[model samples]
Target: MAITAPIATINDHSVRILAWNQIGSWLTYTDANGNSAIKYQFWDGGTDANSGFIWNDAGSGQLAANTTLEINAADLSQVWVRGGAAGGSETMWVRAFDGSDWGSWDSFTLTTIPNSRPVATISDHMVKFDQWTRVSNWLSYSDGDGEAATRYQFWDGGTATTSGYIWNDGGSGQLAANTTLEVAASEINNIWIRGGSAAGSETMWVRAFDGHDWGNWDSFTLTSQPNLAPVATIGDQSMHVGGWARASNWLSYSDPDGDAATQYQFWDGGSAGTSAYIWSDVAGGPQAAGTAITVAANDVSKIWIHGGSATGTDTMYVRAYDGQAWSAWDSFIVTSQNTSPVATIEDHSVHVNQWVRASNWLSSSDPDGDAITQYQFWDGGTAADSGFIWNDAGSGQQAASTAVTVAASDVSKIWLHGGAATGAETMYVRAFDGYTWSAWDSFNFTTVTNTAPVANIADHALHVNEWARVSNWLSSADAEGDTITRYQLWDGGTAGNSGYVWSDVGTGQQPASTVLEVAASDVPQIWFRGGSATGTETMYVRAFDGIDWSSWDSFTLTTTA
Candidate 1:
């Protein structure tokens, strides 16, 4: 084998290859603001040393004909771009030499992310974070190579990290994903960690803290943008707190009080420059002027009483101003009551599933409240008469439909506003278990409060051979003083192995405890919790074998939305 040494050099635009081979290269100058006024030449390899060459080529304002540079007998074999212009460190792939027939163009090479570091500890290695994306909830990413991580850490941006990146090892503790976490939900108050999941994606859970003991980490999961955190806070005149809003949610507050109203505010996470809103003088006028609103980790935006006038029930509209544009009226009339409403505007969320369980109000209240009159949902204009009527409509408040998990998808088009308008305040949250109704859970909020409605169904998932984990936070409360929020899971099987089991990992906080999951075990099927105790949360899942249990591994993936 023979190794050849490379060579190259140039004095002017033309390199004196041997002697007669000296080819003078000149750049063709153009006028209309072109970037090609420079002197580098894209010679086509053939050049004539003839005296009139330069004058002849300049006449056409471009290469007179296919101008080709000639290579002397021993000219450097490698053809390349002659260097000129700014510093020499420009990106190589994007700046190729311009040839007679070829123009310089951008190369297709993608920008490179640093490769994942290798690992020296643990069974499987995990790297890269899938936080707050618009696709899969908490879909993690890491180099699948056996190398151990150089460092490991979880950050929510709420707490600043000196370095945005985490170095593996002694910086953070180590734990198995099985005995570790399940799934996670990013929220405002109770941001859950130790989020986990299992096979069949059925089992799910999260660990949460209210600045107190870790409560049973609830079970939950998102269909989109899992890490998308809560963005707003809601409250009434008495207690101005405990409100929940997702990425693009729009909670409506109607002002029935003939006059306008006022409000309080605070929130986080959004592009402020693009997320601001404007008020219009006319009904449905364009957003005139307003500061750019961003939903950062801690920044806040609120629509207070701009002062409304006019006598008697003049219905002031409370619409949501998404960064892109204003959604339809979020709420209708506020009347005399002062309220800071709350609602979650989901993504591509078309039809809401309202399973009619034993629905109805107990015999009492208004003169017409004998046995609970009728049920009708709304789509802004008028209430839809087409709703499933319950045969055994029980005596309780009907469900008002608020989000269980805020933005599983995106906040773009799905501003959840439509709902039941004329039914009793409370309703049952029922789910169809492929057969009968899985029992109804009651929910209610006062007119003086800004409590948004609750989602009527639990996140149900299935994993073969393992228990169908159902993260049911569908607890309820009745206006009659009986509030029941305990959710039950059941499988129509001969044995009890198919029913829902109540197990918790994270302490349930308002927002943090919003994440959950059903995970797969080492033995084809298993269930356990994932996430963290502190704010640095992760997704993990564990499985239980009849004889023993396998360890938990943090979920590492990059799924397409």
Candidate 2:
């Protein structure tokens, strides 16, 4: 009897089988003559199987299937299964036997599901200029078929195939452009990216592969931030009047990008503007306001500022430029400190009890150009009790450690009186500006001795009726070159004797007292008259120099009838 063709039924016919998965089918038909089915055979391709006959699941030989047989896709190899007859539509032949010859091979259709491409997505990211950043968290992929992504590609620009790099798990370096690179499942999360030298928005394309096909190219924007401006800070500065302050010592700068200051600007006041003055030299000579000074980054320490003419505090504003942008203005306090006046005194020589002029011994100068208003003197140096200073008019004397207000014109009138003791003597002096006093300056001098003058006179003869000039014998001299100021003539050794000295005027001989005083020019006009007895009369004469008097001199006058 003829066995009817065995009919084949699949457990889930509508469902498509994934590649490399096994599919099972069952036969439900009865033989026409009621024969029991015993054996089965399967073939690939068509019902009339030829060289494409189905092999055993172990790939050993032809397969003899029972009512149900598991078609092992693993045996077909992924290539044959994936390359189905018509775009994944595969055909298989199956037949059943009823203890007799096998029925005609039945054809059934099987479909190999295509692998779903992993969807690659990338989110926008931000990066600093010239910095390397990671792109793992910014990239993502998904596959509907539960497949893991195995490879990834990156491109600098929007296009993927033009020029791109692939991640190399071996760290041997990036693969060639558009080159597919295999990676471990864990390595897919460690992608890295870097931006170019320029700072701006950048676009790139990325894709992932799940062993089968590459996903669509995903684009992401890389925003590179611009270079940051430098920050500037300034510290307070202190300098003496007429001194200089360097900007580099007080002004400092820093940048987040490590950029150096390339240019600098300076202002005189607390704010930046061109209204005030800023000197460039120590002398406070050349000056400018709110101007930019060109300088090398490494030479910023050379910038200098002048502490102006006056003593007090001043403010200065400054800023720096870093190729990209200028930093904010910073300020520093410039303290112009006061400078004390310098005092000086010169050594002098004077006689004992002589008066010395302040102008010849004391002087001072102030660096800040302040006036020297007052002077104070004290006994100092090798010898104490050197001298004493007098008030403005020399009317009153002042002791040591006293301040005297002597005007410039009165400097010559203010006297320093020499002490009673004679020898090398010293006195200290100091000058005072309007604000401060200078250190003590020493004044040194030597006291000398003075000598008296000498008087020379001769005895004269006089006639009773005839006048005799007695002044012709009078003469005087001094050892110190002092002029003879006055002269005294007497008769009885002292001024108490009777009248014997006389002066002859144009009218007649005037009877003068025993003592006679005359100026130095009148000494030649004196006339002496003898007494009535007239034998030997004595006259005493003396001369006076400006500082000391000469000893007494004697002269005798005689009268003849």
Candidate 3:
């Protein structure tokens, strides 16, 4: 008989034997005349004919005529057969007799198969942290002779092994089929996971037994999963030529996987164009892509930078690392240099009637190295609305408050004449680049008054018989070289009182010339004559300039006989 065919089957309340009936009837029959007949006998021994079989005759109470029997193929011991199969191989023998005829011996064979090994699979092919996960059994099988059981092991980087890692009872580290395993990941870990399985094999060389013999161990590998990268955020930033940005005040970095940012990178000046921009560590220098920074988790830092001798708006960028990978770049701005000009002045003092130049007094420069495009001047004070002079016609020129057009650079050495007034005068100036203006500068100076001239004359007397000359003793001078334009001559009395008529010539007086005569016009000298009963005559003289007159000088004369 074939091994797949059943030698015996038990169903309902009866057992049916197919192969046995083919060999012979193992049954007893009864006829209407109350006589009993035997067809076959039951057996429990090796294959050897009716001697190896046990017999139960009809009407002898040994056989129940058609008694029911049960058998179990899964458990060969319950088959009620003799001996047992080795390696799922076994043989049996039986024989039956009909009344007076005997049948040849019949035989039956039995075979049983063993169970197969189990396979393991995880619910998530890429297992990650921060969530509960299960390692379920998938496509696992068992042979007809056994059942399957499974266990798991884990490793950080590479494949897992039984001896390499200790197996827990389906807990945190160890895992089993349909069981859960959770691993918490933080910034401190490098985060790469590999899962291992020990299917049907918990201990060394030991397999799971399912009411039968043990099975072999089988394992599988799961895909590796890594942690997430960090995120970097940049805040608004601004800096002057000599200033720096404080990282703590302007940047934020974090990770979604509960990890801390391990490093920071920076790029300064212009655009952060692709890979052309070199990245630098937060602590120092330009570093490679994977280089570590000196900053700690959630810590603050500073980025020092200069204007680099350049001006105008500039840009900067930054990024962070979570020990495993780098985050996307974040951008900000770094303004460099300036355009406003600075102004300075030098004070001066001038004597009255002197001239002062304005151009040589003030100077200015731009911080950004820009050209000094424009300049303005204040006459008396530095008030914004004060007297300001500006160029109105040329490039970068402007009109002053007085609406007067000034030529570019016409302000150079502009002369200022000091008047008679003696006091301090102020002049303020400011400069501008093309974009911005500078603070006002101030200059102060003083003007002094001029001295006046003086005249002198000596007293002289002339008798009626004697003539006197006064030109040698009369003179006038001025400290400022002012010319003596006029001279006046008069007596203590009016012309009627002296009764002497004097001839006037050469505008009444000339240096080193004789005085005019009273009666005659031919001589240049003046001669005093005695009047009727005159004792003495007095005369006064003075000099006059365009703006002032000298002090009067007087002369006395007596009549002589």
User: Model 1 scores what on Cα lDDT?
Assistant: 0.25
Predicted candidate 2 versus true structure: per-residue lDDT over 222-338, tens digit per residue: 666766888877888777656666677777789887877887776666222312235543333444554455555666566677665556776777777877688888887877777
How do the residues 117-206 of candidate 1 rate in per-residue lDDT, one tens digit apiece?
Answer: 322111211211221222122323233332322222222221112111211132232223334322222322122233122111122333
Q: What is the C-alpha lDDT of each candidate?
A: 0.25, 0.61, 0.43
Off by over 4 Å in 3: 1-226, 269-302, 337-428, 431-561
Sliding window of 10 residues with minimal summed lDDT for model 2: 78-87
Error of 1 at 107 (Å): 67
lDDT of 1 at 506: 39
Residue-level lDDT for 95 in candidate 2? 62
TM-scores, one per candidate:
0.14, 0.36, 0.29
Give per-model CA RMSD: 42.8, 24.6, 27.2
Q: What is the C-alpha lDDT profile of model 3 across 1-561, one tens digit per residue?
A: 211211222211111111112112322233333323244333332332211122222222222222322211122222232112222333444333334443344445533232333432223243232222322222233444233343322322232352112233324443333332332211112212323333211211112333323345444434434567788887655444444445555678788766677777666545422222232244465433333334554444544334323345655667888766788888776555455788777876544555545566667767767667666665663333322233323433223322222333665634544545567667666776655567777777555554445656565444444434445456668766756566555555333324232433444422222332231122234323334444666655666554455666666655444
Q: Report the lDDT of model 1 for residue 531.
A: 21
Which model is ahead, 2 or 3, in terms of lDDT?
2
